[model samples]
Target: MERAGIDGFVYQGPVRVSPIGTHALYEGQARFIQLQFLSFALEDAPNLAGWRQKGMLDGEYGEAFDAFLEITGAVPSEIDDPAVALFMLILDIAINPSRGFPIQIESFENFLIDVDAGIRFVRLCQAARDEKQVLSLITEYSFTQYAEAADILTSSCGYDHPLAVIEHIVEWQEHSPVAKLMEEKRGFTYDLSNIVVRVMSSHFLAFCDDKLSRPEFFCWPGAWMTGARASQDITNLFLKHLSLFTDKADDDGIFPRAIPGVSEENAVKTLTAFYANVINYDLVRQWILSDGPFNYEFGWLTSKHSKEDMTNSTKQAFQHAFGASPDSFTYTWAEVK
Candidate 1:
C-alpha cells in the first residue's frame, strides 16, 4: 500500500529489470508475459511473499489480500495470463487461509467460484481419464468436490482434447454458454465472443509454448476461430491491449467498462498507468512505432462502423502516423478527426 517507490515505472533496484526484476535483479510470448507480469505484480512481490510466508506459518490469511486486490486491481473472472498468474499465486497463498480469502471477504467479486471452475474442470478431466479404464466418473478427484465438473466432462466432452470438447459444446450443445449468447444477442456482437476466443486461444497457445506438456501437444488443434501468426511483440501488444487497455467505455466492440470493485477514478489512474508502462517496453514500443495503428479482421476497430467510415478512419489515422516519430508515441491516441 506504500506509494512512490513501489510504482513500476519509477521503481528502482530489482523491480525494474526485465519488466519484472528478479528476487535480486533480472522471449517467447511466455517470456514477454512473464516480464509484463512482473511489472504488475512486482510492486506487491514483497507483500505477496510475506503473506504466503505468514499464512503458511500462522494459518491465517486474507487481511492483506483485499489491499492486494486494490493495489493489483485484479478481477477474478479476468482470464488474461497476468491476472490468471496472479490468481494462481494468490490461490496458493490463500487456499486454506484461516477464513479463506474470498469466503472471508464480504464481496461477491472475490468469490472462489470464478477461479475454481477451471480447477474443477481439470480435476474432473483427470478423473475421467483414469475412469476410461473403469468406465465410471467416480474417481477420488471427481468425488472429492467436483462431481458436477465430472458430470459435465463425462456428459459433454469425454476424454478427448479440451479444445475439441469446448468447440463441440459451443457448436452442438444448444444450451451451452456460447450457443445461448449467440441466440440471445442475435444482431450485435458481444465481448462474450471475444472472451471465448481469448480463453481458448490462450489455452492453445500456452500449450504450444509449454516445453513440458504432453507429447501429443504438438498436433494441430481443430478449433475454427480466426487467428493470425504473430511475433511475441505483436502478441504482447494485442494481449495487453485487449486485456488491460481499450478504446472507450461506450465502445460496443468491448464489454461494458466494468472491473467490479475498481472505481472509474482508480481505473484510469491505475489501469491506464499500467497500460502505458506496458507499451513503453523497448521491444513492444519499437514494434508499435514501426507497424502500429493496427487493424485486425474482427478487432474492436473493424468490428464496428461501415466500410466507408472504416476506410476514412484508417486513412486519417495513418496520415497522422506518417508524420510522427518514435518520440511521438504516447499513451494518448493521435487525433484522427
Candidate 2:
C-alpha cells in the first residue's frame, strides 16, 4: 500500500494445528489447511500482494521462513529423495497452483504408496499434532469427499469463496479503490481488514474441520519401527487404535466397519465403486490431453518415476487401471509436440 501512498491494514499468522490428535486425524487436518492456503493463493494474488506489486509475490523466506522450517520439526533439507520430489509436487499443487482440477485425497494417498513414502507422510502428521494445531480428526476416504469439507467452509464460513473472493480482489485491483483514495487526498485509510478477515476465516475454518473435530493417535516416535507401507496402512492403524480404545464405534458410527456375519457382497460392491472411479479417470485424462493448459507437463509428471525404477511407475499405473498385469511397462517423456 506504501507504493499507492496509503497505509493501515490488519494481518494474521499462518495459524497452526495441534500435534496431539491421532495420526490419521492430524494428517487429514494438515491436508485440509494446505488446500485452503493453496485455493486462496490461486484464487487471487494481487489482494494479498497489492495491485501495484501484482507482478511479484514473496516466497516464504528470511526469519519467518526459517521459523517455518524450524516449526515443521522436520528440516526441509532432509527431503532429498524421489519421494521428496513427489511430496513437493503434492505440496506444490496444494500451495502454489492457480487452480488444480479438483481431485481425491486418495490420489495423493496412493501416490505416497506408489513412491514408498508412507513414513514421511505420517511424520508430517505427527508434527502437526505435536504442535497442538490439528483441530479436527475426521478421516475422509476420498478427495471428492474431502472437498465436501471445503464446500462447507465456503458456504458456512463468512469468507468469500476462495476463488471467487480472490477474483473480486483482483477485479478491484484493476482500478484499486485504495489507489484512487490516495490520488484524491493526501492520505486515505484503506479498510483491507475485509481481505484479512476473509483469509483468516478460511484458514480458521479449514483447520477446525480438518484437525480439531476428530483427533487421532499417531505413533510418531515409533513410525519407523512400525514400518507402515502406505497411507492406508497408517490410516488402518489409527482406526484400530481408536476401535481398541473406544471399544466399538463412536456414538454416530462415523467410522464404521463391516459386520462379521454380513455377506461378502458388500465388499464386492465397494470394489465395484472403486473400479468405477478408476474408469472415470479416463474422462479426466481425456480432458487433460485435449484442453488442459499443462498437458505436456501433466503427462510427464504423471508418467515419470525415478531412474532407479526403470519401468516408469506411472505407465504401470495405466496398465493396472486397465486390468492388465503390471509386471512390465515403459513410456517415453518426449516433448508433447
Candidate 3:
C-alpha cells in the first residue's frame, strides 16, 4: 500500500466469547482479528492554518464572511467556518423552502464526502462567494442553481477564466466613483468608459487583434471610439496604432468618433503620429509584451476566440507595423535607437 501511495493501519487481537452462551461451547475460543485503515495525508497541512490566518488579516476572510452573510442572510456568530457556512446557505437557497426535510442537502453533503472534498470544501465555497455577480447570475439565469453553484465553486478554484475576471472588474468599475464622474462630465451614462479603460490598460493589442481577425468579435467598434474620447495620452496612443490593425473607415475618411471631444482632424493626426513613432522605433511588439496591468488581457480574449487566431492576428499586426513578425524582430529595448 505504501508503494501504491496508500497509507494503511492494521490491528490484531484475540477474541473471547461468553461461556454461558452455549452449553456445548468450548470454555475459551481463540480467534485472530485484523483490521486495516487507509487514508491520504494532506500535503503542507501546517501551511493551511497560516494561510487562513493571513487571509483573515488581509480582509479576504472578512470579504468571504460578508458574502456569507449576504447569501445566508445570517449573523456571523452562528457559523464556524465561513466557507462551509456559505455552502450550507447556498443549499438552503437552492432547496424549496416549503419542504420540511433537507434530503437534498444531506445527499449533497454525502456527495462532497464521497469526493473527499468535505474537509476542505470551504475554500472552494469562499472563492464562489468572492465573485458575487457570478453567483447572482447563476441564481437568476440557471434553473439548477445548486449544481451551477457547485461547478462555479470548483472552477473558481481550479481554473483562471480571464473573461469572467474582466467582466467582474468592469462590473465593479461601473458602480465606482470614477465611472460616475465620467458619466457626469461626459454625459455618457454607461460603463463604456470603464470598459475602454480596462481594455486599453489590460488587453489593448489582443483586443484589437481579435477584432481584426474576427469581424464578428468586433461587435462594438463604437467602444473603441468611446475609448478615444478618454483624451488621455495613452489612450490616444492605443487608438492611433490600433487603426493600422483595423479597417479604414468609408469614403468620407470618417471613423467612428465620440461626441464633444477632440476634433476629427486632430484625433487622426495624433493617432497617426503615435502610430508612426511606435512603428519607426519597433515598439509595436514591445507595447504588446510590456509588463503592465493589461499585459495579459489577451488571455481573456481566448475565452471566446481561438488562441491561435488571436496569436496570429497579433503577429500580423506587428508585421504590418514593423515589417517583421514578433519572433523575427531583433530590436531589444537596450538596442533601440
Steric clash pairs (candidate 1): 22-26
Alpha-carbon TM-score of each model against the true structure: 0.20, 0.21, 0.21
Residues 1-337, candidate 3: write the lDDT tens digits: 2243322211332222211221111111100000000001223322323433544313332333343445434343311233332344332222212112212233332332222221223344456557654434332211243345544654665522223332334443355663554333233222323333432333333343333332211221222223222236435444534432233333322233443454555444434443333333444454566642212124332244565765666566657755866667344454447
lDDT values for all models: 0.33, 0.31, 0.35
lDDT of 3: 0.35
lDDT score, candidate 2, position 181: 34
Full ranking by lDDT: 3, 1, 2
Separately for all candidates shown, the number of backbone clashes (residues 3 or more apart, or on different chains) is: 1, 27, 1
- Alpha-carbon runs more than 4 Å astray in model 2: 1-262, 287-337
Q: For each candidate in turn, give its C-alpha RMSD to the true structure in angstroms.
A: 20.3, 23.3, 25.9
lDDT leader: 3
Better-scoring candidate (lDDT), 1 or 3: 3
Compared to the true structure, candidate 3 yields what TM-score? 0.21
Error of 2 at 9 (Å): 18
Mark the 10 consecutive residues where model 2 has the least summed lDDT: 216-225
Error of model 3, residue 15, in angstroms = 56
Residue 84 displacement in candidate 3 (angstroms): 33
